[model samples]
Target: MSLTCGRILELTGNSPKVVVACECLAAGGKTWVLLHERHGNPLASIDFFLKDGFHLDEVLGSSEYDFELVALQPGDRLFMKPCQPHFVFGYAHSICLDPAASHLPNINDFDGLMDLLSACVLVILGNVLDFRTYRAPSQDEYEKANKNQQILIDHEINSIPISERFAICYARGVALRLINWIRMCSEIRGPGGFIITDLPSRFFVQIAQTLIKYKEGANASKLDLQANCTLGMLTKQIENVVEVDLKISSLWSKRHLIPSGSLALANQGDYSVQWPDPGRKKWSSIERDFMDAGVTPLDRLCFDTQHDRQHLELSVVIPQLKSRSSASQHPPKRTKS
Candidate 1:
């Protein structure tokens, strides 16, 4: 099949190396396909649905590659090696792995992964900051606005500095790409296993701090306010992931080191099959480690001028006031007398 906006690569498995093409599909998306391609023969295809959501359907075109209509739900995955050509449909946010002609060495490279993650963070933040203008309004909404209103809206959107606009768009794109990478990593592991690692915790802190800095620097305008709220939510999500990873790592280190049978019994199940959910109280040491690694606290990172002023008044001004009052209560001694 002809490829557009997708990566084509040659991947080696138990069988001989073969080309793979992969594309991402948002909700309610479909792709056209050709049974044969000049790049390479189609080796395999896979679909991964995130959040236990969405449905995927596929239909084969050729009689030689006939297959029944199959539906895959959230957390449900489908894979076919030596895959036959077929038209694929996606009902939710999903990634499609197909045969391609080239190789992507950076896919597994640590530096490449870091770069991709950075790009995704930038995209997500940019989209959040200038969402109204970055994303076009729906047709229905566009039709409802009066001509004058529409012109005014457009003018206001255009008035935003070009530099800011570019920054917002770039951040949004990066965020999206990062999320796609996360989904792809999850899918590669197959079912009934956890992808345990400290990567998210290590990298997401910088992203969260960057968002906090942006939010803190933003003005009180409506757009800035909206962006700040959205960024805060995104930061919280990243923090949650980091906390969970810390918890799991702690448990894995402490519990998994024991004998297999004992560990299973202690966990009340297979240690590798499930992730341990430790309490929030257990996160203190991990938080300290993160701080040592230069991750600022979310509250401090998203500092507000008004809040800082209040804090200063309480800590510095109020204490001086109390000291003066106590001295006054002593009547300044009998010095005046």
Candidate 2:
């Protein structure tokens, strides 16, 4: 059975495409749609968003640029480039052509396909929310919740005389795994040394709540163990990225104090020198102290020489810092008398 929406329009000899339409209701907070790559970068697409007061942010390299909030009346369209990451947030509805559908054989069941697509998108949004609001539940609370959920599952299994429990369990497991994969991908830094796109943490929380509603309606079991594991991994990755980013930002902020000749050495390790005591006029003593410490004007020591993946990643961010330093008007600090 083909899943073609028949809403296909032909413009300028392009291949026919399937239309995916999404409507987001106002829930007192922002709603976001992030597209990291266009149909895996093989197909072309055009997006039409209902103007209704939405904000758009374009991701460039490691920075977010060109933020605009505009209201479009119905029937307005935006052209998107392949592999370019962009996101639209706020209450709105959008219709876009699916480039991935080009690879599929004829789709005749448009309604069914659309329903399936919508359900999948909704679940992903819910998973995002679950990830955003994830906190380590207390041991007691976790056990209690697990026990209660298990009881419910057992009751449902007994109610269904035919044994389909295994199928259901496997499906749930796959879903849990898929959610983990998505979380991991979302946290990964792209080639430009930035996350593919910035998503507000609360956005994922909202998605999780929505998914919970669906799970309740479907009477599906939650894979607590898998979810917890995925959450732990996500938390660790987030912490590591935050630490590195903080260090990079701090180094950039103090760039004015670093001499150009010493910048490369500083990247390798922290280098410190004792300033002469002006109050006591003890230049001779300061020279002797420097000699005792084996510290030269350009001497640098790698206190912690072990290189890790995080440090390697910082190499990409270093160029951006260098550019900022060059653009600054402040002169480098005088380190020598």
Candidate 3:
């Protein structure tokens, strides 16, 4: 197809192939653009989809929604749908790099937002909400997606990078929508002959545990939801069994390393020591002699004469050195005179 000179310059690909233009298509529509840089290099781009798609006619009626992320480049083509059925062209220009792009709605958009949403939340919920044809997207899934979304929203509120902000919002929206369906499940729960069942039928059971994870809010506000069935609760229920790994920084300069086996190989110890519960910053000579600046919890430690493994294993009790007197049951030599 060709356009009149007054509208757009027609091209036969003789010299200038990069035409700065605009295009639009509906969801699942496709278009092509020619990009050949006369100078400089081309950069990679990511796509973000809108949470809602509009009809060309519908958008003409209202200007409320915005594209998620914008690919800032001239000679760039944004292939998108216009409303539901129509598709058109939009060309990316280099001028979009300027702040003046605020004047143009198509300048900077979030195309990656769509994939981010699908990966973080949609993938988890879509399979669970699958129905015969049109499955109802559940509230639980929506809530879970929302947790991912809130991070994006926070970025917006905090003036974070535009790309990150858009990605988070799409994720959060998916999680929140699934939770809506979960609410529906609770309202329609029926008994299975009063024997003990959560659903009306064993065959039609819901994936309740997985669904409940959606309700966990990213914000600390969800802490108030202690008794409620939510993702955080499930995490907390098994927190102890899932040992948390906490790393510690060096207490001293950490310039010195402890030796292994006081009697032998005393200078060959490797690794660091960590004791967060120590009440004082200063250490006695005894503590310093035994202290390992690098690693903690060695297999054994010296106690005057003998190496004691009990000292390393015991929690509160400090290890006492065994002596000839302590080892004997009774004292001798005092009865003579």
Candidate 4:
């Protein structure tokens, strides 16, 4: 809540975060917040900032990026959308409370939906990068090491620069948990869907290349693809690794949820729960080329026999139609008669 002089929250994306400035002691007390807004700063610019040692001025001044720098004074409240790349800086001693969670706006149009989903993609990639960057300390080292420990056990972690400590903690534990939570919530259902974040195929290719440079390994089957390559060619390339006909879905296609009463039954501070297999899409795109279809090297093109896919589609559609038919038969709520 209170930041000492010259303290920084570091560069990270926590969409739907609100910072309420409560008080400021110093004469020039202010909180500098940098944000990545929709259709503003490109991801490439942020990526450049990350790779180039996180210099605040360089990125902000270098290009005509749509990044916002909000200077908050006492009694000021700032709200940010989901997956907006942002960081906070304390100009002088100050107090602020930052509470962030998914708060999606009413999505009535296509552009609004696109904006929301695009932010989610940025979230996924940002977390992935964090996961790759931070190495968690071993249990032994973690147990023995403390902030004030004279003889540090987690020397590996201790050696990390102060600027990255928050990121390290986030990468080690928070990143994967958040990723799973987002994936679970972001379903492609109707209006009732949770925050719908998706990763585009082209962006995946770009991020994959960036990861290669950052020394992270891609553990999936590799296929050389061009923007002009047809889906048939892609299928053929994938055939090398898979036996059955493949159906390409967005990386965010899968949906998962915790079971009912799973949390209510927890005791002895044990909150562990097992998740079921993720639900896959019953329908897929019929586009021809990789460019048109948006298939990338990193997108997991799940394999399914053509017959099986058709069967799954039928299974889903039949149940839906039956439900609709059953609903229509029920009389509408009648006024007093």
Q: TM-score per candidate, in order?
A: 0.23, 0.21, 0.15, 0.30
RMSD from true fold, candidate 2: 30.1
lDDT of 3 at 155: 24
lDDT of 4 by residue, 261-314 (tens): 111111212211222235224223332332222222222221122345569999
Tens digits of per-residue lDDT for model 3 on 1-337? 3221111112335743222233322223223323322222221110011112322233322333322344323234343331112233334211222112222222012112212222323322321232211111222322332454434322212123324323333433344332222222222212332222211111111222223323332222333332323454343322211111011112111212321111111111221122222312333222221112211111011121122334454533433334444657555657666
Per-residue alpha-carbon lDDT of candidate 1 for residues 273-311, written as tens digits (9 for 90 to 100):
222234222333222232222222322222243356458
Stretches of candidate 2 exceeding 4 Å from the true structure: 1-12, 15-70, 77-84, 91-129, 136-337
Top candidate by lDDT: 1
Error of 4 at 292 (Å): 32
After superposition, candidate 3 runs with Cα above 4 Å error: 1-29, 32-57, 65-118, 128-337
Q: Is candidate 3 or candidate 4 better by TM-score?
A: 4
Q: Rank the candidates by lDDT, best first.
A: 1, 4, 2, 3
Lowest-scoring 10 consecutive residues by lDDT in candidate 3?
A: 42-51
Alpha-carbon shift of residue 99 in model 3 (angstroms): 31
Residue 305 CA error for candidate 4 (Å)?
34
Number of clashing pairs per prediction, in order: 24, 12, 62, 2
